[model samples]
Target: MKYSIRKLALAGVALTLVAAACGDDGGSSTKAGGTTTVATSTGSGTGSSTTVKNTASDTGVTETTIKVAIHGADLSGLVKAGAIKGVPEDASVGNSRRIQYYLDQWNAAGGINGRKFESVQITWDPADPKSYQTSCQKIIDAKVFMVLSAGGGFPPDSTPCITVDGKTQYMGIDAVSAKQFKDQLGNFIGLAPPGSASAKAGMEILAKDATLKTAKVAVLRSDWDFANEAFTEVDKVAKAAGINFVYSDAIKVANLPTADANKNVALTVEKVKASGATSVISMLNFTNFTVFPTEATKAGLTLKYNILEISSGMCTSFSAGQLPPEMNGASCVTHWNNFRLDNTGAKATDTPFEAQCRKDFEATYAAVDSVGKGYPAITKTNPGVPYPGFKDGTGTQLDMDQSYYECNIMNVVKAGITGAGGNLTKKTFQEAIYKVGLFDVAGIAGGKGSLSANKLWLASNVQQVAVTVNPDGFKAGKDANGLYQGKCLSPLACFRTVPNTVTPLTFTLS
Candidate 1:
């Protein structure tokens, strides 16, 4: 079994049709980058034990292969035209290369349970939503076991034949978030560290600083669904510490002209200033956030603290540049991880770990015989259009984006394979994944693994925050391994290392 070049997919056990069995209840969304859970939703079983055939002759060894798909993100044509940088249309080589690197590693390691890993890279236009179904049909044609991180399945006009067997799943690099997916459909788990998690983490950070805790905050966002829920938690935590939460709004825009969008941003700046807001938590995408700080600076607003979510910072298109000195020192949160580089600092480091993954990713790419093959330096910023800097450091530094997230996917897949106890087929691997705490892919391809699954012990296994900028004088874009130890302008100038991190807050819906 070999990997497919056209689809950018690895091989899997041949697919077979199975009658629907039983499934779980409606999907759930949580605060953290939402983690999705997939369950069998075939037959209706109520508290009855369903029989899982362990015998190979439950009739033929019904081979199963899980097919994972990633459609290149759709950005405005301007992005490809070099009017803007950082979109799938003109992504940096390092970005897709990292992802391909990991996929190759999976295949070389004998794939999942000796079943080769298969992936597909589809390019589509968002104007045509029907593309989602067309791509889905292709996977169905292949009779793949399941879809991973896939969207643009077919033309938006018709979502036909999206289901594969009784189990069909979909996810993507950054767009199809865990919470958003669960909100739209049922029975598929999306794992993008939920918005709730980021919101809460960001809030806890602000709460740690007394200067920030006492200042008023305006929870601003374009979408209230997840942002509101996240800020609700932030408000709750801030109130517990007696912080003054001044004002918040959905920033309703019926027909936002460029000026109107800028005005809305100005409104936020004015509101924050009027209310004496020391910190602003804007749950905005890069496109919208691009307007915020500019307006705030124009209004001569001085924020004591500020935090932008993943979109504003990680994604290159809308996050960077043009902010005034007030924000030159602000911090942003993201699920995208940069490959760990230097561990050297005033404190401890993970340089060794970073080196290992970098080596593996590089080696994996070299071994692959493909047209897109190329060596990517760990420091080479993600390949998006125009090629933006990772974050503002003394100079440009290497950072991860979709590439890093996908790399982690590769890591987890290896973990899942190892968890299978050397049983890598799609059919047998599920048992190892669902049951084992961590999947260890130790024996395959002679890579290390005594490697256990990095599965978050609980849903709260949210990735911690790192500072990209510091008014206190720390550099931005370096792998911030020290938490908040570098030279910062002020305590608040540096990132507030949130409490309860070593001990994650338990998620209890009370």
Candidate 2:
């Protein structure tokens, strides 16, 4: 069982990485960033039931409800088990609730094509390999039309499978061997491409800054699927941007914080030092990102610049000041900007669109909280669902990322349904998604979200990248323990588009 769990984690990590890379878009035409008034799509449906909307399609569809599922980790359980600390129990569950909030709003306005959205939460601890199969089986048994967002990685091999009319179908959103499984699993649609856009942004930073570009650069990453793709993408950009890599190495992704893990990071740092590398581009998971940089700083290695790709978990670590001082000047490529960190006063925007998005987000958070706390019946439709404490969220990093994902899910479903015209089915949904071109997410994450034709990735044109600096005078909010958190010293700068190759553009950040 232990060995199987390990194997599943590796596979799960691979698929997650695949989604991140796909988000890279690999296209070159530059589109200016910011919000533009885009039209919304409308759908038609006939429903009688309060929950399920009866659609012509019978699979995972009814007269009133469109059945979907969200599969991921139970963060509340993790907190209780002592597996995690200092993070909100609501981190994952709150994300799920946000989905419900959006659905409730949609239902109030009129559901997609007259069919209300209903989602089942399937959660398990990632540590328990058996839990993967268990949770997946539950999703399969429920016969959901699709699985939207996965809060954490799961082993691909343990995914539940079912058959209808003698045809086999696999339970969803497969990132493992994405291209290989794409045709086979017609129902799978990726939520977001995390690493690809960041890779582009980080490389651009290196290229545009002369003092940093001339200095020796090193690349460090874990031996995982996304890390490999990140390194390759970064290396390609570096070579083209006239920046050269002085040293590079891959370390094992598992068994972290152990002696071997410590040794591996320490060794990687030594290689960076030996090669006279003054800057480092780290493409690693949260553990490796925190561990490697901390070790580098402890070794007394002063770096001119450091760029990192960190997940929401690491964002918590950064807020907690667990990251080394070497990261003080570093820039992170992540999903959303921290309002607390925006020194350019983007939070005080004058645009109605921007203001409305912000207002809606705050309202959504409130709605989700009320629903979680058993306040409004509309919010608490999922009675038995777990709702984590609201005090844990800061509306900066993880919460923002989760909200953006919910927006993505809503956008895609609307587009797919509208494109379906009169009928909604697994086949039509997939086809509509493929045909989705130039989708605008109504200023989500302070940028326009889009999906290109036939692509499984969602791109955020002109997204914001936060810069790390001294946490003085820029405090926004508090953590669960009420510790003051620091903000990014830079404004949420805009980019017209993220290209596959590096393109240097000067960004003025005081």
Candidate 3:
């Protein structure tokens, strides 16, 4: 099962959307060593004011300011380059979507004890570990009531809260997957995917695979933050299952762009082969996923493959039809299944929840750039359509938009708040975080008594492995791969499952 902070918040989403201009905080606090400047309020609703304090111990002085950390995606940058709609690069979809989803649901359902919930976003550098601590310290300094999906793994930080030993509800992102992060998981009503989500699922997936069960396996992962949690879980699972948990000799690739970087995959395969393993399990950057597939193909060695049993490391690339040929048979599993509108039965069953979810997500995303030609599609030349793009000038082109990786973490946060078993509120959200952990997030009937797995908050549950090959295409039937009739994205006319072909077709049918 996939697990991260299960995050789903950004900035104060509870703030009422006011058409009247909300002015900036003109006053500044000078009590602390540095001046505390209050951020201007953007909404005109009856917004409440809270004092955020700075760490007296860190600065040896008390500052007056509630620092709510937030990520600022320069969406305009991508829009200008015709990459995306003019939505703010860092908008609700990043984190606020979760907060808004929850708050809207709560408000509609009768909020926490009838009180509205508030949220904020804080972005940190995935490369800079200090920012992680700093963001947490800022929250502590602000003396806020609690933290939310304040952090993530792909981004490498989870909810950083004040020492639970000190405060009660220091809650934020629920699950703590990384072993190293376990130290950070003190006392906060937890809201993570299951604590054992990745480790258990990764192992189970590998073990169940008949072709890979007895095969020697190599685990490749980052030595850093969130991704390491899934990597570690997969490693632990692989070891427990008696699979060759080869890593010492396996390559330790970094997210760097260097000449030596290209060699990492060959070295990894060499280590795997040296260990006499037939397969390799990689838990590395999504960006680096191309490494092993390309390198293994070059090495003329192809075997069973499994990657991303933890976080969505390079998994999107797979579904995007971008995995290299070597990964043709490899599988990457996640708890959240891609909700395809084409699945009529599933659409009928989960349509309401999924629709509301998709609607909430898109609306929140559009909130930032409601009038831009970013989403909903925008273009005069409808090369493949009558409408050109989804956005028909009203906002962004949201039409033609198909399924991508849905950060179910948002759903987790939403579930936590809803399942708190109490009314919605900041405090209730904190409780909701833990409630999510204790209860099944998916709320599917006859779901319990299974292996150790957790659910997202919305009562939605899915675990699917996606395999997508990239630019070039190939074919392998069960006759070739045994129990695996692999298909490739081919544009070439080669109907035979020969070796490799370029311009591969989009799909193959028996």
Clashes of each: 58, 12, 51
Instruction: Order candidates by lDDT, high to low.
Output: 2, 1, 3
Off by over 4 Å in 3: 1-119, 154-175, 178-196, 224-242, 245-277, 312-322, 339-351, 366-464, 470-510
Residues 210-260, model 1: lDDT tens digits: 776656777666543445556666667778877777877777532243345
Give the alpha-carbon lDDT of every model. 0.40, 0.47, 0.38
* Model 3 lDDT per residue over 380-419, tens place: 2111111112332223232322121232334544554334
Tens digits of per-residue lDDT for model 2, 1-510: 121244334444211111111122122222222111223434445433222223335346554567777765665654565444444655556556655666788789877666677878877654454565566556656666666564434433333232221112233322222322333344444433334444655666557768656888887776655446556667777888888788877886443323345467667777788898988776654434556766777788877645444222323222323454556656544433322224332232224444444445456655534323333323211101112222223343223312234455556766776565334555555677667655654323334444433444443432324334333422344434222343322111111112222222121111
User: What is model 2's C-alpha RMSD?
Assistant: 11.6
What would the TM-score be for candidate 3 when compared with the true structure? Answer: 0.55
On the 0 to 100 scale, the lDDT of residue 342 in model 1 is: 14
Give residue 448's lDDT in candidate 3 (0 to 100). 21
